[model samples]
Target: MQTSDFLAELSQLTMGFTPVVDPIYGAEVYRFLDLSTSNTIIDSVDTSSAEAIAVYIDTYLSKTGGKVAYGGYLEKRSIYDRSLYFGTQEIQLKRNIHLGIDIWCPSGTAVLAPVKGRVHSFKDNKNHGDYGPCIVLEHTIKGDSFYTLYGHLSRASISELEIGQEFNAGETIAYLGEPEENGDYAPHLHFQIIKDLQQNEGDYPGVSSLGNLSFYKENCPDPDILLKIESKVKG
Candidate 1:
């Protein structure tokens, strides 16, 4: 399907806050975070250290009385500079544009599906700054087929899984992995919507360089359109 058509279909998936992570932290308390290089606060600490970034997020969450810190779709992040897996420091070639919505939470936290889907593939991408223990689910709704990727998952998340397993909306599909196991970048879930896998199995590019930004932005639309976690729930 065309990106426009798929995005249009996604727009009609649902409205209101759809929890993609554990609901223990109600939708109301979820905070949108800024991790891009422009965030001057990032310069205050070490971005290369997973513990440092985790602490930074923890502080932000505590200060805002938020349970979860989310956001990052199409966000240009400088943290990727810490690893060569992304590419050289060259601007045009560097894959610094993040294509997924990262949910900052404690490790081992339950990760849920915002929509019902079946397992497409799963793998443990062990690169230095890559998604570790990832799972991709193929979902078909309204005759439009797409995918949702859950990355940075615990090993157990994919250890006993079958290729064609099915999961329902809001079902616990995986658990967050620790920094050591999750490409050493703090504990969080990298959730993305993929229109086309291009034969990719468990792994997909979560970041993109400026030169290829346009194409990736289309292939990977804003996940918030489906989750709607950015909006506050009305009391």
Candidate 2:
């Protein structure tokens, strides 16, 4: 079966599941970030200060009565330009389009597994504007295998975690890291689903140029298919 077909079946199988169990079910609120819109806060973002980004997200959440800010798949963000990994002189086309759903919340928030999976790999990507501590899980549903990546997690999350360790759905796997450790950005979880790793270990490209959108889109499907948080975003 194709990746899309596999994901569609998985979505149906997990329609009512909750990806995040922290802050209690139905107790917390969520806000959606529309980076594609020029009139929105995306255009006014400083992108330099983690404090500024946190404050912007917190302010938006407060105004919208949300506890978390989420969204980003396929959305091109100038924020990625802050990292040389995306804007190096050697590369002609810059990678600004996000390939995952980032859930912005307070540091130390519990990051949970949405499905049963085994640890495929883990790493501490210490580069500025990088994923920081990351963990990739390999999962098989309906006899089809795929991988899920959790990024921007605290060191403690994987301090004792070993390769091939298994975790169940809703199991606490990691916690959000502070700005100093989470790639110098606000505390958030960069969650992505990949049909293929391209031999990449704990790290994978979370952003790509517009010219490569088609390829990345096919490889990294919308994570909301698993999280099911899109409908809960505050309008």
Candidate 3:
């Protein structure tokens, strides 16, 4: 696609989240990520406060309101997964880093469509530290075709999503996968944008080595460009 066409297409599909509460809790944090990070990928997360994180996830998922937190991409990483776990330099030297944007929310939280698209694939990646249940959608904005991956969702999220099923913009496509089904972490949405899937579906390595950074950089654009959240930094 031409550069101008791509930009125009991007503008069309980019949709904002309909906040579920009167005072959205994380809008400022989402803004911070957008403004502070040029690349749009978040890394170096501290997961030590597991209890606090779990509570946050529960709150979002338990809501009955139609509104949901708006963000571009959802993501998670594992301290047990050697490739992403932070550890001694010796261990980190051999493994890849975390990649993709995480939409931290509660389990059962409804993950809606930012734009119209077709179901690409679904998978039950049942490993303990893997994306337990996942879905991918292929969309054409303007004239360019691209894909978005929704990872770490409840098993039921993918149970009824048939390949090629058409979903309209703002439709509720899937609910947030619970922690048990979502690769054993606190519930959240792992959203990623892919220019080319390279024949992979239902799952993709959001992270890549520093050596292959250029490849991921070009293929995966920052999702927040579409989400439009303002950013603020805190110490």
Candidate 4:
């Protein structure tokens, strides 16, 4: 497939990778994790249970000696099978392809803004398998405007956020929510960059079906363009 102009834009948009999660786990202790269906290791995981998956992630992080385990852009995952919120059992229509990069760490970990931006919207999406409390920030750097989404956030993250609330680079905007409140999944940050939100507010499609992957792939380019997490090794 051809590359997206937006994808190219995202690649060359900034000078270097910026840390959205705590810089405490920045380049040094960051590790790339594979949660896709192709990774046989995940097959042994109990993806349906948030606690079970947490154990799996914790074990991986401990063994890898990494503070953060992050990946899953456009990854075809089987974890969504337990939730009807994604779709029925039909393979082609199932929204199992993750469209964002997830940063797994302990609950209450701080989520930061990689760049200056104002709040676009914030909401509590309380579905069985949803983003839970989420925030979308509108960013304008180098005269280019787009939005960055922070999902699976703590409830307090959105309790006082205004539509135009501002956040600077590295400012604490939210915290990772617990599984009880974060769509029943392990505490993690779902970060995505979007060129267009399609009129969405705080919530957006972080997963896509096989039939609609093309459109989502263009609209939601790999966040790795800004993160460069895959290129870094644990120090």
**Per lDDT, what order, best first?**
1, 4, 2, 3
Mark the regions of model 3 whose C-alpha exceeds 4 Å error after superposition: 2-8, 15-96, 231-235
What are the per-residue Cα lDDT tens digits for candidate 2 across 1-235? 7766786776874655365536463524767766553536666878878898888888888888878788898886778777786775334367888999988888999988888899999999999899999999999877777899999999898899999999988899899999998899999999999988888898999988777888999999999888878654421
- Return the top candidate by lDDT: 1
**How much is the lDDT of residue 166 in candidate 4?**
92
User: Which stretches of candidate 4 lie above 4 Å from their native place?
Assistant: 1-5, 141-144
Give the better candidate number (1 or 3) by lDDT.
1
lDDT of 4 at 178: 99
Candidate 2, lDDT over the whole model: 0.83
Q: Which of the two, 1 or 2, has more lDDT?
A: 1
TM-score per candidate, chains pooled: 0.96, 0.92, 0.70, 0.93
Clashes of 2: 0
Please list the C-alpha lDDT of all candidates, in the order they appear. 0.90, 0.83, 0.60, 0.87
Report the C-alpha lDDT of model 1 over 85-109, residue by residue, as the tens digit: 9987788988999999999999999
Candidate 4 or 1, higher lDDT: 1
Please give the lDDT score at residue 184 for candidate 2. 93
- Between candidates 2 and 3, the TM-score winner: 2
